[model samples]
Target: MDTTILIVDDSQFIVDGLAAILSRKGYSPIMAHGGDECLRILKSAIPDLILLDIMMEPMDGWETLEKIKGDPDTREIPVLMFSAKKITPAEAKEHSLSIDDFVSKPVNPAQLIESIQRIFSRRNDIKEELLLAEGKGVDPSLIKEYGALRKSIEVDRNLLVVLRSAVGRDQAGRTPSPDEMAAVRALEEKVASSERRIRELQELLARTAPPAGQQE
Candidate 1:
């Protein structure tokens, strides 16, 4: 449920700065110094979104993105091309299916965050569309409730990510501050509750719908 973002850049400064910014905003940010490292990380873990730097040594962002899209395991992860270089509309159209969005270099902090949110929103909409397409005669309101609960879980998970950052739990993974401990406990509970509701909604939808050939 945690929204983990992979910040792929050749420059250590950029990756670190972006990671700091994202962590402060309650999103888990993982750093990959170049295309190779990014591919390596993908083999083990798939982040929710990838902020890919276009210019790099040895393998550029476009090549890296091609490899990413070529692999079935990693193909579906959304990518936002980050670079200082200007891309033409023709180029954008050429790779439209490969990447979700693009951001020029020296991104505005507020606008960057907004862009990331928009990407996630689009992902949610796509998921809802797919689910709805598969579900005939399922209550539209019920699907909406499922989506809302899923978003609630994501929020709680982000809060947990924030608390982890606050206490440096990722490194030592030991005792946390009392306040953080309490907050983490509450978030865990909230996430669990939302997950349970999602399951219930799933079951309800499954039961209320007619078989594939039969119309409601």
Candidate 2:
């Protein structure tokens, strides 16, 4: 894969291990041993994704994250918090808007991979119909609706991830309790609604597209 991931950590051991896993999974990894190095690397080369450790000396992950997000040049890169630190619900909620995702240390390789894949799917894979409709002369309102639906889908997906992580059951091959199941189901329903609206938008795009030789 051409996708490059920058892995920033204070520990060489963690960096090396993560690099190995990412390499075997077909990702090219750029390594940085500290927050300063990570920022310096960002100056010259921006990777497709970043795995940032949260507990560094001098500059912790939050500081680094704020700097990264504050910079217009590097703000758009998806960041995943790779740390052993327990993220309390409040911290997670506060940072949810800033982070693409997080993978707690004692890293479950499967969970890490899944989170990366989901982020890529969400951020990188723009809907073909959306692109085509934008290129055509679709009504601005229609395009706005499509954007809203896609955003709704993204919100629901994020909620699903947070809920599953909080319950600590989805990935363990164990059944979820009734409460967890109910929450998951509600999110799933919202996702389904958004998806259905997206399909309708696609069909409307097809119908409303300008005729051949007249598209502008």
- Per-residue lDDT of 1-216 in model 2, one digit per residue for the tens? 399999999999999999999999999999999899999999999999999999998888988999999999999898888778765444554565578777778788898999899888866455555666777878878987886576456655665676667756556767767876676676677678889889998788778856479866
**Model 2: how far is 64 from its true place, Å?**
1.3
Superposition TM-score, candidate 2 onto the true structure: 0.68
Q: After superposition, how far is residue 12 of candidate 1 from its true place, in Å?
A: 0.6
lDDT of 1 by residue, 1-216 (tens): 779999999999999999998998889999999999999999999999999998898889999999999999999898887787655323443554577666777977776788799779967774875476356666667766776565556544544554455555565757767765565576677679889888897777666756568774
Error of 2 at 122 (Å): 2.2
C-alpha RMSD values across all candidates: 15.4, 5.1
The window of 10 residues in a row where model 1 has the poorest summed lDDT is 88-97
lDDT of 2 at 160: 64
Note the clash tally of each candidate: 0, 0
> What lDDT would candidate 1 get against the real structure?
0.76
Clashing residue pairs, backbone N/CA/C < 3 A, model 1: none
After superposing all C-alphas onto the true structure, candidate 2 shows an RMSD in angstroms of 5.1
The 0-to-1 C-alpha lDDT of every candidate, in the order given, reads 0.76, 0.80
Query: Runs in model 2 with CA error above 4 Å?
Result: 127-129, 136-216
Give residue 211's error in model 2 in angstroms.
Answer: 7.8
